[model samples]
Target chain A: MKKAVPLYIGTAALCMVGFAYTLYQIFYVAPLAQAPLYYNQKIFYYHVPCAFMLFAAVITCGIASIKYLRKREERWDDVAFAAAEVAVMFGLIVLVTGVLWAKPAWDKWWVWDARLTSALLLWMTMLAYMLVRKYGGAGAERLAAGLGIFAMINIPLVYASTRLWKTNHPSANTVPSLDSSMRAALWLSVLLFTFFFILLLRLRIDAQRAERRLYRCREMALDAGLFE
Target chain B: MDFLQHVKTLAWKDIRVEFRSREIVYTMTFFAGMVVLLFSFAFLRESSAANGGMITDASLSPGFIWVAVLFSGTLGLSRTFDRERETGTMRGLLLSPMPRAAIFLGKAVGIFVMVLVVQAVVLPLVALFFDAPLFDHPLALLCLTLAGTLGFALVGSVFAAMLLKSGSREVLLPVVLYPILVPLFIAAIKGTATMMSGSMSETWFWIRFLLAYDLIFTVAALWTFEHLVIE
Candidate 1:
């Protein structure tokens, strides 16, 4: 715990600096080429990174879920639970920022476009994962692990079907070549978000571990004739 | 016993019990018919009253038919394990020497047969009520229905078993099942729509998609069913 403090502080500091720089670049350095939608596209830097973070968290949850199922280790379950919580948070940010970007660019807050629709579906799956974890009694962890694994497998199918069905969203190559400075800013934002994600994931897992330990300790005390 | 024999025995047992009781089929078929009736009243009545061609059209019938099947299929899927639980046979089955995958496959096949029976009745009723030209491409429609229903049952059976002990099995099954089956649903809808329109060009793509979905989930459920069912 003592050794982890400086690393946490360093990531927190780096994230703050990177965030400020991203804002500065978005407002001043990047060219406002797409008139009227200039500010809207600015959400892209934050939105895309959040989207990436969401995927990262989900993948982590899936991997951790697999580990939990294999070993039945409470640590893996904690990690899976933490990663799912973070994934839901990042998913919410992606959806909200997606809407913010959409309202300005598409003249509407929502469209059944493939990417957006898949994201909504992904969000719903994560929500369902959490619900099962919460309400699935006795063997809830195992059930949730199964759900996490299923959700991971479904993601690719979701992407494929959405692409096959219809695609009103921008195609893969539609993003024009970014200016060098814009590219640097985007990479920096991604890096910072990655660090932030790791930091939060570690913190959440630690908290959950502590909570489990406390529960076990309480059970032991009750068994030992402590006060009710 | 051989694995195939085990699976068949379990499946046949479920079928015989269901046949003797006649509970699941009657309820599932009735429920499916009611859903179709409700759709006819809501959409068909309103559209015909307004002289709109939407509800009478072939394109919309695919969606209506699948919706009915999906809802009623959920009814049967949730009930798949209830008999085992209520009779305390679930524990006995778990203790049996049969491979867990056989248990899963058997239950899935049982549900698949049940759903097919319900669809057999419901599809004709849909044709009768909505005037859907279901016979235009009968073979294609049959293949699509089989693929779709198989995928649905395979996924639904595992989840139903997992949630058998949960208090809110009915509500939770659909909530968890629908989102995962979205791709399958999309493929089925598009495939059925194309077939009903008498177009074969792009129907194969959706059919292949459904096949792929069934392949992936069937293997996945088989692999995971053991872990999901054991205490």
Candidate 2:
């Protein structure tokens, strides 16, 4: 724990530096490709990375949930819980920034376009998973694990159904070519966000482990008649 | 073979209970009818005050029918496990030497049949009230309804079981079920709308989507039901 403090601080510092660099590139380095949408499109740097991190967290949550269900290990549950929490946070950022981007790009604050709708539903599903974890009784962990897996499986179906229903949102498939500098900045922002996501996940898992340990200690103390 | 037979027996048990008591089917059918009635009042007022055209009713009936089915189907799903929980039969069933997935399949089958029955009643009522031409493509409408109801039952049964032991089962069941069901709803509504418009061309896409959704969630629920049901 003592040795890990410096590593944590190092990662935080590096993330701050990367964030600053990303902002700089977004404002000045990346060419203003789309006219009249120049400054507004800058939200893409942060929004896309947040969206990517959200998906990565969801996948991690699902995999950890499967492991916990199979092994019934507290450690796997902690990972799943942490990933879910992180996923919700990133999902919020994605939605907020998405709206900000949408208002400028589409002249509306919200649209029922496939991508946006699916993203909102995904957020709601994650929120439901969190609610079940917090309020579901007795076997909340197992129930939440099931929900986690279910939500993960539903993501593609959500995307597919939305696309089939309508296609108002911009398609990733038809993205015009980005300038070399813009591509570099986008990749850099993604890498930075990935690093930050990992750091936050580790901290969250550690906190969960400590809380569980404290809970077990309390149980042991009670059994030993230390409190009465 | 043994597993399937177990599923059939368990499903029959539910069917028999429902048939004798007539609680789930009656309530589901009534609730679905009420939903359609309410939607008719709302849509009829809006459309009549706007244009008083039959075309508007025809255009809106598909969505309204699905909405009614979804709400009443949720009511039926909650009742599915409530019966077992109320009678304290869930534990006895779990204690039996059958695989837990069989229990999920049985309950899902029961709910599927119940929802279909409710749909059978509600569809004609919706058509009658809205004066919509829903029977233009009977086979297509039936196929879409079956796929949609099966998908709903598949997901709802697993969630109902998972929440069976929770305190806020009624509230949380729909809270958790509805968002995940967005895809199924979209497919069903689109399919129904296309079918109502008398064009079978685009309806196939939504039907295919519904089939894929039903298949995916059926496998998922079966795989996870055992984990969800264990104490």
Q: Show what share of the native A-B interface contacts model 2 retains.
A: 0.60
> On residues A30-142, what C-alpha lDDT tens digit does candidate 1 reach at each position?
77647768767778889888989998998899899888888889999999999999999999999999999888788899988778877888889889988988877778788
Root-mean-square deviation of Cα positions for candidate 2 versus the true structure, in angstroms: 2.0
Candidate 2 lDDT, B1-231, residue by residue in tens: 999999999989988989998898999899888887777667554444565543336678888888888999999998878888999999999998988989899889999999999999988987888777788888888889999999999999999999999988788888789988989998899898888887798788788889999999999998888888854
Off-target runs (Cα >4 Å) in candidate 2 are A173-176, B45-56
Q: Considering every candidate listed, which one attains the maximal lDDT?
A: 2
Clashing residue pair totals per candidate (backbone < 3 A): 0, 0
lDDT of 2 by residue, A1-228 (tens): 668989999999999998998888878989885776878887888888899999999989999999998898899999999999999999999999999988878889998877888788888888988888888877878888988898899889988777765556666753347787888888899999999999999999999999998999999999999998
> Which ten-residue region of model 1 chain A has the weakest summed lDDT?
A167-176
Q: Residues B127-205, candidate 1, lDDT per residue (tens digit)?
A: 8887777878877888899999999999999899888887777777887898899998888888888887778877777
Worst 10 residues of 2 chain A by lDDT: A167-176
Q: Kindly report the root-mean-square deviation of model 1 from the true structure over all alpha carbons.
A: 2.1
Candidate 2 - CAPRI tier? medium
lDDT of 2 at A87: 92
TM-score of each: 0.95, 0.95
